[model samples]
Target: MSVPVPYHATAQRPEWSSLPARLRAEVSTRMGAPVIQARTAGAGFTRGFAALLRTADGQSAFVKAAPHAEQPHLVDWYAREAAILTRLPAGLPAPRPRWTLWEAGWYVLCLDPVDGHTPRLPWDQAELTATLTAFADVAEALAEPPVELTALGLPRLADLARDDLLWWGEVAAGREQVPPLPAPARGRLADLVTLESRLPRYAAAATGLTHGDLRVDNVLVDTAGSVWFCDWPWLCHGPAWFDLVTLLITGYATGLDVDSLFAAQPAAASAPDDALDVTLAALAGYHLTAATSAPPTASTNLPAHQRWTGEQAIRWLSHRRGWL
Candidate 1:
């Protein structure tokens, strides 16, 4: 009899009824029937509207929308997701795009509905195993980028993390507030900054398609126990073990024996220990820096989530380095 803590809290969702009438009509037209019910999706931090919609004809689809006026960046994200989903290899365990529309100053996407549940926080071992297995399969399946998505111009891990990881240096120079760091991590800020500087070099050898953002909420477990990965906005080209490292950080924070888990993964096992350390440092710096900033519009809980994740990353780094 205890309330379960969510992996991350989602922001308030815009109701299906709140969409403009023209947009609703277009969605109904695409689904081939009038939507009779809409249940808001209870996962993710984006301010965009997402919901499971059922039509009068019993058809169902996952619909997501974001108005350009409110979230211009999200509109681009949705467009990117639509493009990525369409180009994903056939048989990948991800939702298929049914249709996408840009009208009435809103970008809308309809996808094949995935009947699954988000993984529990702290993770159930079996669920975690399934997700890991799926990550490996997906990574292998997407070893190279598809021809259609080549124009996405996804930045390399090195380029993306190089500047973002310097937030600690900014904090040290009094340009930004000190993010909440554990006692052990507080005294080692300089070391972290130094470690972060080497991230690009460590990340340089990475070569493979990667789900840039991998976390508990972005994954789903179907009734048959298969794992389904979602949120393709951050899809990019990076190291084969990139997603695994991200997941292991969360696992480590939740007290899982991530070292053993990493050893068990073929992709992860191939990565050098130093490379993994650099990746962790990069992630820790990025999260810690973003966590200290002002909350993003419509995502009031994002800063808190980022702060918690930053703490976890720092704690994991401290353990790895035996920092005091």
Candidate 2:
């Protein structure tokens, strides 16, 4: 089996000293004291500058900054994340946004500090259970989303899937080349296309709010064994089970009993019997198609990650379908 990809160490962040002097000054001023120490974080996929900043008086905060002039898109994502975090219900195990600043052509967001580490690989049942427990509460709270949040005019997942998630259809239409696959899966391309094409309709029937992006790198396990989620820009209206499947990809890679895990989660309670299979097929097509493109200059490991994720999705689907 391929090793679990190192999700945490893929991000490339700049040192505190390397930030523009004016930006550092503004951040320190906002912190209420002169900055004393900074520790760069290794998690996340963006090239944004994220670090734990300490003040001379012992106060600390996690700060993320992106060069707006250089990468306007990343900066926009961070700004949207700040907006989403502030609107979420209190006490959701997500870091609360403290403030935001713009200086020296950079956009910065500061959040409440969470004393935790990214969940390690070769997944442990205990950690996996903790993560799921945390998400169960999140699912319950978001099951009927608040009117205020819905008012944000968040794009529906079903809508986004129409544009970004229908890679198998593209392949079948000859718009994109078919990616290499195992013999079993290769022979069943038509079935794969059918399964993947159902996601938009399946997701359209749900009303719950989903994290939209829940992977190992987006979660943290605290010292007390409580799990906390991070990153909020991708929040959308979709089936809760969707995030469950995305998060469990790491569990599957570690050889965990993911089928049982999926069966037990409250998030999956409303899922249709074939939801998991449809999701796996859709993901397999998306990742496999994405893996063939040139790696982004920002994250070199992304293609590798896509390839492995696609492979895992296919393997997981094949096992459940008895395609062997």
Candidate 3:
């Protein structure tokens, strides 16, 4: 098989000019200066508008908007992100929300822009270390969900896995098919299915705010080597180890010694062995299932990315279970 590519193909985002005139005027008025220039951001899979804006006075802010007509779900996501960011504890290593607006069928959000770069693929060890260290801090800060946040009706990890982590079941029922697997995995499909079915039980009792989508693209490392996590729409309450395990799956694909890394992480170290296995199975099933489908309209390369990560997850699990 060919080596799978690591990145997804992002759609061209909407430009500033595409926004309604009144909305642009409102953004300028709020910035206290006329808009000087706007450049759309290249990261992320959402087919909405995302850009870096500069005001006449040279102030800079990150802005994202989505028209309800084209992407109603994304509009909801931006609104959800704004709500979550506003409630995050002060001084956390995340961008602060500046403003949010809804006007003329568009949902807009402004945020403080970070001077940082997304981590390189097949991660540099030093950067990976910094990311893991920063994640520990993030976990500690969100150890207890604020009463206000719990009321947002965020989906629990257990509940999410029930629906999302069932690719093998789909295959077993002939609803989906996966590419050929190695001898070890081929024989263990039944075991994989059994393991995945236990996801909810293992995911239960996990408590904390999790960056539900933790990946290299979603993280930014500043010059000072601090990690700033972005894309908060998927924020949910779950075990602190959830995010770490998510990172580890990608890290393993990138050639990191994930076992060593997991041993060093305090949050991960506290998780029961069975819980860890269940999380891995769920993630493997999710990515593998997603990989078998056609790419979504918003991203042409997402299937390849998922396939690569799913392969890594399978390899990682094989090692842990001493599979052929």
Whole-model lDDT for model 2 versus the true structure? 0.88
Clashes of each: 0, 0, 0
In angstroms, how far off is 182's CA in candidate 3?
A: 5.2
Off by over 4 Å in 1: 1-5
User: Each prediction's TM-score against the native?
Assistant: 0.93, 0.96, 0.91
Minimum summed lDDT over a 10-residue window in model 1 is located at: 1-10
Best by lDDT: 2
In model 2, which regions exceed 4 Å deviation? Answer: 2-5, 294-297
Cα lDDT of candidate 3 equals 0.78
Error of 2 at 257 (Å): 0.9
Backbone clashes in model 3, listed as residue pairs: none
lDDT of 1 by residue, 220-255 (tens): 898989999999888876776767777777688778
lDDT of 3 by residue, 114-162 (tens): 7677777667778888888888988888888887778788888778877
- Highest-scoring model, TM-score: 2
